[model samples]
Target chain A: MAVVSGSAEQTVAHTPSTPATPGAPGQTIAIEVVNLVKRYPKATTNAVDGVSFSVPQGEIFGLLGPNGAGKTTTIGILTTFVRQTSGEARIMGIDVAADPMSAKQRIAVVPQQSNLDRSLKVREVLTFHAAYHGIPRAERNARADALLDELGLGDRKRDRINRYSGGMAQRLMIARALMHSPDVLFLDEPTNNLDPQSRLFLWERIQGLNARGLTILLTTHDMIEADQLCQRIAIMDHGKILALDTPAGLKTLIPGGVSLELRVRHAREQPADGASPLLAALRALHGVSKVDETGSDEQDTSGEVTFYRLFAPDAGALIGPATQAVLAQGAELRDLHLARPSLEDVFIYLTGRNLR
Target chain B: MATTTSPTASNLADVAQSTPPTLSLIGGAPRPKHSRLGLILIAFLAIFRRDLAVTAREFIAFLIQVLVQPLFLLFIFGKVLPEIGAAQAGFGAILLPGVVALTVVLTAMQGVTLPLVLDLGFGREIDDRLLAPLPVALVAVEKVLFAAIRGLVAGAVIFPLAWWILGSDYTVRTDRIGMLIGIMVLTALAGAALGLTIGVLIKPEQIGLMFSLIMTPLLFTGCTYYPWASLGSIKWFQILTLFNPLTYGSEGLRYAMTPPQHATVYGHTVTFAISTLATQWIYLGLGGTVVAFFILGVWLFSRRVVS
Candidate 1:
């Protein structure tokens, strides 16, 4: 219910010290959403509630959230597909609500679901899309050819889209969206339901597009996808952006920098007095920040094994000491894993629940 | 070992390295610059062409659906009724215009309504059209225009069929060519407007009911089987039938295609009233209805689809 206005420029202007965040300082904004709200007919709540963010030109920005988190709704509003109840949005400095046609001319959208005409051939889909943008027929043809060859869909140009697989259909959709050389592209869950190989292929293609300086706004709930692909991400939930920063920047928000998980056997077999000693010894390590015992149903019923997670500023450096500490406790080490806090962990830390 | 890249990967790499090109597909060559009006025109044509291409691809289905009912009606009413001596010798002439008008209504209603329902409900293909850089109302207008063209085509197809089947008995006056063309165009426009309105108003599930409750009543009361002058004996029915846009269309066609000797002025008062102001009222009614329904349809469509 909070109406936050005039915050888009400030939010995007607060440049992170982290050199990893993409986009140079003072880059022109490709998209700016300010306190956007959309209340569907007869709905009790807004689908997108007072959300604001900006995507800098040439940056691959991500709206990361689970289903019904308003990522798609926000995209819908930016693309002029859905009207907002209040506030403003601009695409390439053109107000979307005030002059949608001009805004639409500069942008292309790949919806979460496939909306391509199934009856049209792959080439026709691209050609028609370009035509919609007032591209000349011959030019559209050449563009379609280049895009088809680029997307690895040249062989299927003549084939009806009905025969295409899920991956092929998605690639075709991307090719169609690119035909107009839109200044900004909005991809809503572009990789949803794709096989792992297809997802990787698409990722590489998207990366290549980004390298060429096309501003992209991508919506996804896959934390790894966002972490790997997005230069900056806005973690959204319940129609609100809970946090917005580079993936690495958001990961840094976690209290302890990294997590260390340890599995030990024979620790539970010792008297109950042994448990607290093991935890205290792990916490007593030089770089260790926090330690907690986590229950696992897979633990041996005969008290043969137990699991413990240790948090530290640097799990890599503490791994050797943490292992010796468990051994000194008279417990046999079974397995161990050290990982820097991930975006998912950051999300969990912020929301008090898993992203799913 | 040296790493190798696939051909597809290399092509993608080439694309990435190449300078992004301006979009040239819209006009023939990429223009250095384009006016906003020029862009809108291109976008509109693109949408129109796509719709036509898709419809043409399904020509067989359209032919079957559009031709069978009207052809059957023509054969039964124009051919059989007169052949069996159950009606006047010139009944074919009377029935021919009615058949054409009916075909226009049905063709347009189905053309606009069915596809719209499918687009909104099942296929969701309209989303692509809506994304074009044009006003949302323009998209709705494009749909109506296309449907009107289809209705005109349906009328053209039914004309020759009815004429051939009815033989010499079916003879339309060619003397009033301007009036004939005007009425025909107006009828198609009115049909398109009505179809567009119904398409936006009715739910997909209610389509069958629309045909039963709306279309059937329209055809039966639309003066397809009788001239408007014949309804004078039944004043209430005459007034009720006026609510049907097709009535004006059918009556307009009758006035344009039939001679004065064969024209029905059976009920004196109603017939005299119609004849005195027949051309003016019919033209006004049809033109006015088209305008009203088209605006209403566009308004409703923009509300439903844009939001």
Candidate 2:
């Protein structure tokens, strides 16, 4: 285990349901951020507000958020790419704000965009990056060559990167980031627009890196990818984390860990707020957490086909009683479904304003 | 062409004094703390190497842009006019020094500014360099220093070309070669400082307008084709030219290279030594300008990198 630094992370508002390693004694934090706030000049609101999290060594952490969430801004601050308006960030316990130069030495970021130098050949690109890290000549050469081979870029070493495909460019960016052998790696949307082959290869590479003791923090909109790759994931919305948990743990966050959907005939004209005995009975059942009648726009005038989404555990066991309750209220059941919620469902449950 | 091994121009930059590394680390592999300065030096050299690789790839295009205009200016007014019996031969003597000054300044300024603008603009390539372990301010410093070195090289290479073009008309004294070299160094740094300022501040879309609005005005008023004293007919313009750093560069080169003697054209003697700005004033003008613009460029650069 790497030597954990001195600063204790602040208490999180939404702690991961499956607690993080909290880094055992003497185990290090690869990345730490606390109460970070940033407002771009002339902007009305903060881009990142009171964001805090820490990843222990050798763990893969995911920050899952929609487009405008503060994932990128938080990563940017920790990587020394953006200056924050307030609060603290430490990379490997080295204060990023106080001495970004030292912090940069231990961290690497593969940015969302392709920022490759178009003018240089592939081999020179990595070597140049290594040189900037103060790696001596012979070692830089060996590392560049070895990284190129491992990333499948050896064949393209002599060619300029202007002609590279999106996948090749992304692979090159990853290779370049690894040239310095940083203790922590941050990948922002690492597989956003990639083909299946490229995505799979990158996933293996990411797992491979973590297996070798490189702590990684990545941001991605792909719920499945985040679910599969990260040991712990944080769901964020509007610059604040709403929930953080393991994939299964996050799945457990939605009211009773499952959803029950039913389409029923209201038998009379019904408005959104107007409810019946069926809803009351369903809510009163054991293990049922919520009964919502969030139907579609096609609700009829005289008689409506209303949709009820019931939150409960072991929804499969609730079918007979739920249906009997519906019929007793003079409503006819049209369609029914019992589901085990995935991370996507949990995400929609926690973050989505319409659902929340 | 393999800049990976070729120290080339960047080695020249290492000759300049560098600041101490501001990094202090803990719980990592034991760094050679005493040699943090060496690490900073290596990073500076890496930037220089990258610049060399990029510049070398388009070196021919760069040389053409730096040389053609000034050469044409010298050829038409200095050589063709004299050969065709249209103007005085002494005009070539007056123009040769200014042309060298123009080449050094143009080469250095464009060398720094164009790459910088492209990187900071749509390229976003500056991100890689900003990620380098050296202090962010030193990245800006290394670029300015490297550009100055390129300017000095361009100035040196231009003399041989100018000598070949003007032939017998290329009359210069070696006695003040030391002062001439000093002026070239200062001119290159001053021009590079200006380049750094423009590169960081200007948008890529505004680059064309930059040449027109800022560069064109600077070129015309910099006294590259005529002596500073000759602007006496336009006293307002003369004082205005004083504000342009290029004016000092051109005037200093003319003073160092052109003899104190006179040349006759239609029985009128054109005296150059008395018709130029003094070495003290030229040195002061360029030295102060370099320092001022360098500070401004670094501040602007640090802000741009941080945010």
Give the worst 10-residue stretch by lDDT in candidate 1 chain B. B1-10
Error of 2 at B205 (Å): 1.0
Candidate 1 C-alpha lDDT tens digits along A77-162? 89988899998999877889999987777778887778887767678888888788787777788889988887888887888788
Model 2 RMSD in angstroms:
10.0
Give candidate 2 regions above 4 Å deviation.
A1-18, A22-26, A260-311, A314-338, A353-356, B1-34, B263-274
Q: Which of the numbered candidates is closest to the native, going by highest DockQ? A: 1
**How well is each residue in A1-356 modelled by candidate 2, as lDDT tens digits?**
22222333233343343364434445566777788898889988898988887777767789998888888988989988789999889887788999888888788889888999777788887989878888778777877887787788888888778888888899999888887777788999999889999998887677655545567899988887887678778888888888876676788887667778898887865545666667788888777878887666765665778788888767777888889988888887889998777778888778665322
> What are the clashing pairs of model 1?
A134-B26, A135-B25, A135-B26, A135-B27, A136-B25, A136-B26, A136-B27, A136-B28, A140-B25
Which stretch of 10 consecutive residues in model 1 chain A shows the poorest summed lDDT?
A1-10
- Judging by TM-score against the true structure, name the best candidate: 1
True contacts kept of 2: 0.40
- Candidates 1 onward: DockQ, in order: 0.33, 0.22
